[model samples]
Target: MSLSSFGFLIEEASRNVRRNGLMSAASITTVAVAMAVLGSAVFLLHRVQQFMDAQPRQFEIAAFVTMETSRSKAAQLKAKVQRIPGVYRVSLVPREAALRQMMDEDHKAGTRITDALVGANPLPDRLDVQLSDPKATRRVAAILRDKDKFPAIEHVRDDRETLDKLLATTRLIRNVGMAVALLLFLATAFVIQNTIRLTIFARRREIRVMQLVGASSGFIRMPLVIEGVFCGLAGSIIACGLVLLVIRQVSQFAGRLQTPFAFTMPAAMSPSVIVGLLLAAGAAMGWVSSTLSIRRYLRRV
Candidate 1:
């Protein structure tokens, strides 16, 4: 389209919005709220997936070593475990550290178990093996348990139940996120479409006159489409600002949490990417709703 035509459409679109102040505001608010809800759900799903990713470590294999095992021998043993097909990480859990952890737990429970065992530390040092895939946990465990497979590996232990629970929770989050997002997307489209219909209806007389003068459908509909797009874009911009504010507040509040967390919270999407998505959603809602609403109106004419 020529610059003059573009400018005319923009001017007309802006005038339509200003003329119907309340309806325009309502449409913008509705779109903003729907987008915000969907965006929040997506953000939460990302965080949930991060936790789900860390869950496999909880079901990792514990390979105990003989009391006579040396530091060099343990290092060699860890290196050997890393060479295994599915093993991605093999961390050494020294006996002293293990004892300290146990004692710390006991103290929290109001027990002085460490004092009773002060003369000798009988806890065994171990190697913790993390698998690239939790499904390989049993296979890796069985391999470690083979007869005389690294004599220092006294035993190999893994818990399948923990892995199962973690997997279930992740799946639940994914299903719920998708359902909520779809519902919100549809609601946003409806709000934009309804808003555009009202804008067009108010100009029905002008449209009939244009038709009588041999104006093409595109000539009459372009301005209405622009109005719908403006509403969508405005709502999307406001929604993005709100989402960013909410995320900042949430991050600050989370940082002040009194209870300790075992794992770090996963990083959020980059600011640029998030802003781009919000803008795209807004523009898409505007364009799609305007086109659909105009086509529906044109059919009746």
Candidate 2:
């Protein structure tokens, strides 16, 4: 199309939006609401994934040695485990350190359980191993459990079941979020299509007149398509703004409630890319709705 033709299409679209002010507003609002929900879901899924990713690395696998094991043998066992594949760090937690940790916890809980009261420190000296991969915990544990490999080692303790449950929950949430977002997106599209159809219905007479005067189908369709694009663009912008506001408000509310979870909004992208996506989505939705609406009317016309 020529520049003048494009200009005419834009001008006609603006006029249509203004003439059907209520319908335009409804379409924009629907688009905005739908986009906002989808954006929020996307942001939440990303944040949850980050949290889950951090969990496994933080998990500590404790390799407890036999109570009668010699200090030299314990050090040798620690060195051997440290050399194993996937072992990120290996530190020996002496019996005294284990006792100290328990004492600290008891003190924090306002309990005074002295060593004399407990008869003796029953805590075992352990090799505290941090893995580079949380998913390798089981394999790492198995390696540590080999009596021939680490004869001094008595048991291996890790929160394997809890970590598995957490990962499973994360996957479930991701799947559910995607399913809901897709359903909402389709619903939004349908609503916008119907809204555009209503606008086209109101202009059916004008379209018929143009067609009778030998106006090309392209010429007749261009303005409505542009109008749809405008609606989508406007809706996306409004939705983005609303989502930002909601995130800010939620963060503030969480702080007041002393909630452990904090909202982390996505970083702003380059203005050009951000604008492009929003406008493109809006325009595409608008075009699709307009095309369908016009096609149905054209059959009767």
Candidate 3:
């Protein structure tokens, strides 16, 4: 099509929106409301997944060295643990520091235990092993418990039960998130379908006149298609803004509500990528729903 034809199509689409003011507002508002609910759910899912993937919580392996193990032996063991397939790395905590920590705890408990053990630091050296994957902590801990392989290791300790519980909760969160997302998508689709149907009904005569003027089917359909896409885009933009606004407000209350189970409401995707995805989803939904609605009027056109 020529530039003038394209310009005319744009004008017609804009004119239709202005002429049917109530219908246009209703279409945009419905789409926006649906998108907003869906967008909020999407962000929440991302936050839950991030919490599952965060660090420190996954670092659960603790291996204590025997009293017979020398500092040099413990250092060598640290390097060997790092070479394990699933282990991230291990840090050696000297016995002296460990003793100090124990003493500090004793002091906090209103005890004079440190003075009694001044000549001998009875605490064993510690090797805190962090695994590449939290779920593999049990496997790694078992590997460390082999006395023949790691003679310096007296015992291996890990919060296996707690880690297991946390992982199970994460899985539950993921399953719930997926179910919520499906429901929200269906709701958005339903809203978009009705918006398109109502717009088509309001502009039935305009479509007929364009068809009578010997306009190509594509030409007559272009304006409504454009309108649908614009509506979707506008609704998504509003939805995204609302989602961000909600995040800001929630973050304020989040600070006080979460402790020991604290995690950030980080962006699910980069801002640009998220906006692009939302815009594309909105446009695609608008296009499909509008096409289906317009086909109802195509027989007469």
Best by TM-score: 1
State the weakest 10-residue window (summed lDDT) of model 1: 256-265
**Per-prediction TM-score to the true structure, in the order listed:** 0.82, 0.72, 0.77
Which segments of candidate 3 are over 4 A away from where they belong?
53-57, 66-68, 83-85, 95-124, 133-135, 146-155, 249-268
Superposing all C-alpha atoms, what RMSD in Å does each candidate have to the true structure?
A: 3.8, 5.5, 4.8
TM-score of 3: 0.77
lDDT of 1 by residue, 44-104 (tens): 6776787687766645788998889897899899999999998879999999999888788
**28-140: candidate 2 lDDT, tens digit per residue:** 89889988887667656665677676765567688999999988889988898999998899999899988887787668657787645565878778998989988789999
**Clash pairs of candidate 2?**
228-286, 229-283, 232-282, 233-282
Clashes of 1: 0
The candidate with the higher TM-score, 2 or 3, is 3
- Candidate 1 vs. true structure, TM-score: 0.82
lDDT of 3 at 12: 87
For model 3, how does the per-residue alpha-carbon lDDT over 14-53 read when each residue is reduced to its tens digit? 9877877777787787778777767766766676677677
What CA RMSD would candidate 3 show? 4.8
